[model samples]
Target: MADALVSIQILPRTPNGESVIPYVDRAIEIIQASGVRYVVGPLETTMEGDFSELLEIVKAMNDEMIRLGAPSVLSQVKISYNPTDGASIDRLIAKYRT
Candidate 1:
């Protein structure tokens, strides 16, 4: 099995009332459009296809957010072949548990 792993963090430039939901939604849209097996953080949303597609989608998602006035967006992505499609992704949870 193969998968594209991504960790996305959105922060407001000024700690004001910024809607992170839109950013999250855009991320989802991008992931879906990419057609690759993915697991969103907090334990849920999985998508599965091409690594290239995932890359493109992620970039687009970030661009969309920037266009929507979120320049303080940060993203970290790691892609690897799972060999056996993971039933769960504890690695991410552990990494971000703090």
Candidate 2:
């Protein structure tokens, strides 16, 4: 069994007209800081690690964003379980199924 890969896409609408780059940067920073050996989004961040840990890492990142006063932020998070030794696009395919 392989660890689950979680992908979180943040769509933040800042009333202060804040730049989205910083938001994205902050998100990446938080995610990376979680100690999950995974890649970030918009460029297909391929990560490998524990499933539950990844979930916690992602949730924590979102919580941080909300705590930063972006509670109204819109996010699209996706989780996929890729075999440790197999080619899988199940996540991508699953996206359409929904």
Q: Highest TM-score: give the candidate number.
A: 2
Highest lDDT against the true fold, candidate: 2
| Local error of candidate 1 at residue 45 (angstroms) | 6.4
lDDT string for model 2 (20-92, tens) is 6776678788767766566555743444456777667666666767777675677776777655653244543
The TM-score between candidate 2 and the true structure equals 0.67
Which clashing pairs does model 2 show? none
- Native-to-model Cα distance after best TM-score fit, residue 33 in candidate 1, in Å: 3.2
Candidate 1, TM-score vs. the true structure?
Answer: 0.55
Q: Model 2 residue 75 lDDT?
A: 70
Global lDDT of each candidate: 0.57, 0.64
lDDT, candidate 1, equals 0.57
Give the lowest summed-lDDT range of ten residues in model 2: 83-92
Pull out the clashing pairs in model 1.
1-83, 35-48, 35-49, 36-47, 36-48, 36-49, 37-47, 37-48, 38-47
lDDT of 1 at 94: 81
